[model samples]
Each structure stands twice: as structure tokens, then as C-alpha cells.
Target: MKKKIGLYFGTFNPIHVGHLIIANHMVEFSDLEEVWFVVTPHNPFKKKSTLLDDYHRYDMVYEATKEYPKLKPSNIEFKLPQPNYTINTLVHLEEKYPNKYDFALIMGRDNLKSLHKWKNYEVILENYSIYVYPRITEVENIAVLKNHPKIVEVDAPIMEISSTFIRKQIKAGKNIKPLLPLTVWEYLDKMNFYR
Candidate 1:
């Protein structure tokens, strides 16, 4: 059987508790063998200035997920082109991992609202299965994409936390102990990040 991997791609600027929670639930409830946090060097839609360095972000993820054997920090996009497109990353991962891995793009319902705007969005719909988690919105209308037979709506615990919120707190010199994992918090303190 092919190893089912959930590609949880994001900036993961600090890899907070909310991310870990969702990843844990993804594994517990789904057939995914592992959930890889594909850290994107840059997001085309977002401002790059606000982002922490890619290596810093990746290191934080490594620290945050160290305890979870099923969670991995993938640097595949680090070597790829800037303003990385999800479709391209998926295609590359499919070829690179070959028959050993099958991927599901894990995302929040909030992202689904603008999924049509993504590069090669239709190709993504036709090729890979999308697993969406609930966001702040209670009513998610996946029915709009009901035509896509591969979409999967997953009911996972939704946290009200976000990396932006955590970063803001950190910049304001507030304690973010509760926002991230203990190890991550320690590492951030030792490294003097987000100061």
C-alpha cells in the first residue's frame, strides 16, 4: 500500500500549538501515515517583509514537532523557486517520492474561499484530495465544489490561534508561553526571536 502523507504546507512562521493540534488530529482521524509541514519560503499573496527568515521558521518547526514522530519539517520548497505555487510543489513531491507516497493537501476552510484563485486550481482539484479543517466560519460551503469528487471535508478541532496573533504578542513583549509548544518557547527565548 502507498504511504499516505498529508502535506500541511504553510509559512509556519513560529509553528504554534494550533498547528500541532490540527496535525495530530489529521493523523488520528485520517489514513495519513505522516503529516509533513512543508515550509514555504514565501507566499505570493502575503508580504515577505513580515515573515521570519526561512531557516528560522524551519528551525522553529523542527523544535516544535520534535516530540511527534509522525510530524516532519520538509524543506523541499526551500530549494525551489520563490513565490512557490502549491500545484508545482505537489507535482514535484509526487515525482520525487514516487510510489512510496500519496499526498493530501491539508488546509483551512478560510483558504477554500479563495481556492479558485490559486494557480492551476482546476488541476489541483482534478488530481489531489483536499482535506479542509473548520475555521472561524461555522458554515463552510464546499457544495460549490461538489463537482470535484476528490474533496474531503474533515471535522477537526479548530483553534482560534494564529501565527500573526502570536507574533504580535511576541513583538509587544508579551508572554507567548501558551501559544506554542514548551520546547519551541524555550528555543525562541534562547534565540531571542521575534524581539
Candidate 2:
């Protein structure tokens, strides 16, 4: 049987507890055998100025997930062309891993609402399953997708915690240690990041 893997793509500027919670919940409660944190080098919609170096962000994800057997850090997007889309990564992963892995997308409710705007979104919907976690956001215009057969809503906790908020707290010299895993926090502190 192919290993079931869920792709949790993000910048992971400084991976924190909220991310762990969601990823863990997905693996524990769903059919996914493992959750891979696919760190993106560049996201088409996000600005580059605020993003830390790709390696540093990847390192943080590595540190954060090292303790969890089912959680992993993947820098596959780093070697791909800039402004990589989810479809491109999904395709690449399928080819690279061959028939060894069944890949699915792990996303939040907010992203679900905007899935229609993604590149080749229809293709994605037809080819892969999506596991969505709840988010406290104004969801709109996703009725068509909400009932899609491939989309599964996981009863995971609503994690409003964001990397941006953690960054701000670090910049303000506030104690943000509790938000991150110990190894991740140590790496960020040692590098003096976000300040």
C-alpha cells in the first residue's frame, strides 16, 4: 500500500506550536500516515521582504518536527523554480516519489474558501484529497467546494496563532518562547532572528 502523506505547505518562517497542533491532529485523527511540512522558497501571493532565508526557515521547521515521528520537514520547493504553485509541487512530488506515496493537501478553512482561485484548482480537486482544519475567518463562496467528495473536514482545534504574530512578539522583545517548540525557539534565539 502507498504511504499516505499530507502536505502542509508554508513558509514556516519560524514554526510554532500551533502548526504542530494542526499537523499532529491531522495524522492522529485522520488517515494520513505522516505530515510533511513543505517549506516554500517563494509563494506567489506573499511578499519576499518579510520572509527569512529559505534555509533558515527550513531549519526551523526541521527543529520543530524532529521530535515527532510522523512529522517531517521538506525543502523540495527550494530546488523548484521561484513562485512555485501548489499544483507544480504536487506534480513534482508525484513524479519524484513514484507510486510510493499518496499525497493530500492539509489546509485551513480560510484557504479552502480561496481554493477556487488557485492555479489548476479543478485538476487538484479531481486528483487529490484535501483535509481542512477549522479557522476563525469569514469563509465565503466555498459552498461548491465544501461539499466536494474529496474534501474532508477534520475536527481539529482552531489555531488562530500565526507566525506573523510570533515574529511581532519577538521583535518587541516579548517572551514568545512558549509559542514555539524548544529547538525552534533555541535556533531563532541563537540567530537573533526577527529583531
Candidate 3:
């Protein structure tokens, strides 16, 4: 049987406890054998200036996931073309890994609502499974896809914490250390980022 890997893609400006909690929950509660945190290099919609250097963000993810054997940090998108799309990443991963791994998506309830806007959403829905975690979304327009066979809603904890909030707190000279893993916190403190 192919090893099941859940891809949790994010910028991970500074990977925090909230991200770990969700990834850990997915691997523990779902069929996923491992949860790979795919660090996004450049998101088209987000401003490049606000983001930390790509390697810096990747380092934080590596530090944060060090303790968990089943959790890993992947810099796959870093080698890919700029302004990457999820469908392209998915296809690349499939081709690279071939039958060695069965890849799946780990996303939030909010992302599921916007999945329709993604490039080749139908292809993704048809080819791979998506594990959705709870989020405090205002609307429920995803009623159609909610019950789809390809999408499984995992009862993971709702993590309201965001990297943006952490950055803002750090810039304000607040102690946001507890939000991140010990190693990640130390890395951020040593680098003195966001301040």
C-alpha cells in the first residue's frame, strides 16, 4: 500500500503551536501516515514585502516539526515556478513521488469554501482526497461539496491563531514566544524577525 501523506501548505512565516496542533490532530485522527507542512514560497495574492525570506520561513517549519516523527517540513514549492498554484503543486508531487505516496490535502473549512475558485478544482476533487478541519466561517456556501466523497471533514481543534497576529504581537514588543514551538521561538528570537 502507498504511504498516505497529508499536505498542509502554508507560508509558515513562523510556525506556531496552532499549526502543530492541527497537523498533529490530522495525522492522529485521520488515515494520514504523515503530515508534510509544504511551505509556500510566494503566494500570488499576498504581498512579497510582508513575507519573511523563503529560507527563514522554511527554517521555522523545520524547527517546529522536529519533534514529531510523522510531521515534516517540505520546501517543494520553493523549487517550482513563482506564483504557483495548488493544482500545479499537486501534479508535480504526484509525478515526482509516483506510486510511492498517496497525497492528500489538509485544509481549513474556509479554504474549502473557496476551493471552487482554484485552478482545475474539478481535477483536484476527482483525483485526490481532501481533509478539512473546522473553522469559524461566516457563510456555508460549500453545502454542495461538503458531502462529496473526496472531502472528509476531520474533527480537529479549531485553531484561530494566525501568523499575522503573531507578527503584529512581536512588532509591538509583546512576548509571543508561547505561540511557537521552543526551537521555532528560539530561532525567531535569535533572528529578531518582524521587529
Best model number under TM-score: 2
Winner by TM-score between candidate 3 and candidate 1: 3
The most accurate candidate by lDDT is 2
Candidate 2 lDDT tens digits, 1-195: 999999999999888999999999999999999999999899899999999999999989988988899999999999888889999999999999999999999998889867888999999999999998988884773878858899989999998899999999999999989899999999999999999
* lDDT against the true structure, each candidate: 0.88, 0.93, 0.91
Q: Per-residue lDDT of 10-37 in model 1, one digit per residue for the tens?
A: 9998899999999999898988789999
The residue-level lDDT of candidate 3 at 182 comes to 91
Positional deviation of 30 in candidate 3, in angstroms? Answer: 0.6
Off-target runs (Cα >4 Å) in candidate 2 are 138-141
lDDT of 3 by residue, 123-143 (tens): 999999999998866458577
Give per-model TM-scores: 0.95, 0.98, 0.97
Model 1, position 33, has a per-residue lDDT of: 81
Clashing pairs in 2: none
Rank candidates by TM-score, best first: 2, 3, 1
